[model samples]
Target: MILAAIWACWTSAALGQAVPNHADPSAREILPNPVPVPAIRFLTSADFPPFNFRDETGALVGFNIDLARRICEEVDVPCTVQAWPWEQAADALADNQGDALIAGLALSPENGERFDFSSIYLALPGRFVTQADAARGFDPSALTGARISVRRGSAHEEFLQRYLAHATLAPMDDEIAALEAVKAGEADAYFGDAMRASFWLNDNLACCSFAGEAYFRPELFGKGLAIAVPAGHDTVRHAIDWALVRLKEGGSLDELYLRWFPVGFY
Candidate 1:
């Protein structure tokens, strides 16, 4: 429930950082060696669709599921993905009920203290969406005086205040209102989660398009999705991180993204 609430709070409203590529000279050393384990039990939830969910046949499927399988392959270990209620999943991980958690989980200070996290495998960046006709590149000068709609008291609002202080801001109650402001021409653009904006453009409203490159502010959005292992489980954490880097390097991660999100935010 905690994870679900966290996801909902973030998603009901709106809704990549530059990752270090394989070229990073220290990439080899940065990757951790996998620890020997009889089996890797992955705990997740079926509530979060596209990331983690069950199909009509009751099979676990989604980006997170695929990534878990890939992790097992990279580690050369057997893996079992089990769907449980979010609270129980967290508890299970803490109780050693599972070797790792593959849910698309965001990290928080409390959670950070409770569990170790892998390198981000997925990031949700803040983006600007505007009317299709008005879609333009992101340039400070171009949007110098533009009106950008954002949810009041949101990370996006704080980002705009701190970075784009020169632009006029229109605060709205929620993601829908902020987007509607742009659709109605009340605001020059809407700054919010790229996923939500994509959904709006692809379904609810087709009149708007993303205006710029995705913005990655960890404080604003998050560190993205990562594997959550029990506290001090450095081996598992590092193993997941290593596998994730490989996935990113081999283009497997991007392929998975494309498969799930045809209308990608990145």
Candidate 2:
């Protein structure tokens, strides 16, 4: 549980900086070579756009798709990435139809019992957005009685209640409603998933901009995204993890992140 909680708190460096690798620097200088395999079958869902979704040409394309190919290249193995219905991807993996599942599966206890996981490749962070004018000197720590809009019953709301109890909460029905509250001046700020906020910001919502550093509370938000293999498939899991570290170190992972998330959530 602590590993899960600590992994959740892995935040990226400041904006414009290189993407944080998220691997421990104190980790062994020499990593174990992955057991060789004939080919890797990567299974993903077509629903999660920007991560694993079909493009306009009906071609399977997204960050996960690209990453899977890169992993195969790094490991010197042939690979196939196939998209399935979100509801059935896990079953497909369980039935040995795929070597790995690259969908955005959370590293939960229930999931852990069913599959082996690679190192986290991506983690969602909480962020604050406020009116453009008010964003300049915003201080999340100084908000006493300030109204912050968050989705009702979301982990974000729980974060506010635990660490920013001095601030008044205006819980909304959903992420959009929470953001709308800030744009409409009903709340001083909106605190929620940074990735979602990036899309809204890039959508020409000039009324508000990101403020303050991103918050990474895995305990509240759930452990970040990782590739999953069958429960006993250590070889495939190790290969994925090894390739991920190589990708991060070589800047390929950062490139993919910037390509997909142009607004820079972190």
Candidate 1 TM-score over all chains jointly: 0.82
What digit string (tens of lDDT, one per residue) describes model 1 on residues 1-266?
32232222221111132222222223336555544555678999998888889999989999889989987887777889999997678888988889898886569998888888876666677888888877755564577889999998999999889988899999989999999988888999999888767767766446887876667677668767778999887777666777776776676766677677756675
Per-model CA lDDT versus the true structure: 0.75, 0.82
> Which stretches in model 2 have alpha-carbon errors above 4 Å?
1-18, 24-35
The prediction achieving the highest lDDT against the true structure is: 2
Give the clashing pairs for model 1: 15-196
Distance from true location, Cα of 94 in model 2, Å: 0.6
